[model samples]
Target: MNYLCLAGPTASGKTAASLAIAQALAERGRPVEIVSVDSALVYRGMDIGTAKPGAAERAAVPHHLIDIIEPSEAYSAARFVGDAERLIAEIGARGALPLLVGGTMLYFKALFEGLDAMPAADRAVRAALEAQCERDGLHALYRELQRVDPVTAKRLQPGDQQRIQRALEVYRVSGQPISSFHTEKPARELPPLISLEPADRAWLHQRIEARFHQMLEDGLVDEVRRLEARGDLDADMPSMRCVGYRQTWEALVEDDLSELPERGIAATRQLAKRQITWLRGMPQRQVIACDAPDALARAVECALRLVA
Candidate 1:
């Protein structure tokens, strides 16, 4: 199916650009709907930390793939591919442009092209990794993952024992970084992709820090606490493992809320780094400097051309 994609790091103006592009399309008497590519935005109670579109924004433009699931459940690229394909066709059938937007590059890759067939889980290796984790702690395993698979390491939170152990298991089983498997997928027709990236890393880092702090001010810790009160979620869940949620959860557990700001900001910056890495890998995408004064206009122009 033909569609348009706008991707970038967290806090890179992707959401703002999507809203602008949709509004621009509306002004031209063309209908448009945003299909979120973010993995985190799927959860119901994850509004503040995910920076999900507010009621007014969702009222302005139709949004899909958001608030479709609960925090206790996991969302995968395979599931995203199926859901997105259906959404794209439905939106097009309704005479609206299917505009995909978010920093979840894996979902974008899976939707436009295809996902890599990752290796099967080695139970013995996983058990050993679990034993190691139990004995030495998640930090030890996370460090080993950093040594063997830095790309995957950058993508996972240090407290994310589930993915950290899984990365190590894959490395031990295949003797290669999990990142390599993603590159092995055959190239195919991708949607016209517009990437919102900052020209200066520092600019993006500053925004990451500022936005995370803003989440706290908007009740990020309380948000995590409410989720924790659910008693069904933990740091191991993919939802809790999100940048801000995991860091805040840990801080609350450790009885040190003061550390939440630093931890959350640092984790978010790391997430941005991995996102930039993913965007650079897509050589065919159009790049707009998200830190530029005209970034929104530039992104809107490119998106309009794609859908025109």
Candidate 2:
């Protein structure tokens, strides 16, 4: 059975494009269901910042792998792969195509190329590292990583606390650098992929800025405030560490909301850059200009041609 993988940078119109593809397929009597491939969209109460499909959209189309976990709980690529595999099979059984959509390139990579056998996350060690980060700051932990795992540390920014923590945790737990575990391995072969990206970088960046401000107007701050009020979630958690959420959380704590929009937009642009880099490396993907006037029609045509 054929499947669809819709990938793109943040605010590049992957969601709308996927919906259009699914709608077109449905009109052709080949019903399709969307399976979210995003890491942040899996968490509840992170609606605005994550750009989750609203209720009207959900009611119009079937979606899975969204809002399946809480903000405090951890979700991994392995879990996403499992859930996606199951959903794919179920959708196929129902004679509908599965359309995987989002910007989480890591999850897509894991789903296509099997994950490496890295050490399991040790909560105790992770907690220790988190506590150390809180005490000595992320730079201290990054410097420590540089000392122990210079290869990994060199690739990651010092302010990237989540990755730095995970790399350090792997080293402390298994006595091996995380990079060494990234050896090539056989994985499940994915179906046709449609990658959406803007033809103009400036257009994409402007879209990112506009979307972030729209998110703020749509109550992104209030959403984060609600999560903070829960008392269990924090900036250290994977869910809260999401690009926009992290900046907003810091703004809230620092009592300086003035530059939140700018920071969020910058971080989102960086994220888009990383995603575009990853997509460039992917094989068998049809890249489309997401800002085109006929983008939706183009996406539907590409998806149909691929699956055909």
Scanning candidate 1 in windows of ten residues, the lowest lDDT window is 182-191
- Assess candidate 2 and give its lDDT: 0.90
Query: With candidate 2 superimposed using the best TM-score fit, by how many Å does residue 134's alpha carbon deviate from the native?
Result: 7.3
Q: Which lDDT tens digits does candidate 1 get at residues 185-224?
A: 5667767889998999999998988888789899988888
Give the TM-score of each candidate: 0.85, 0.92
- TM accuracy, model 1: 0.85
**In order, what is each prediction's RMSD in angstroms?**
4.1, 2.2
**Tens-digit lDDT track for model 2 on 1-308?**
45789999999998788778888889889998999999999998889999999998998889999899999899999999899989999999999999999999999988888788888889789889988988999999999899988999999978777789999999999998899898867555657889998899999999999999999999999999999999998777889889999999999999999999999999999999989988998987898998899988888899889878
Which pairs of residues collide in candidate 2?
none
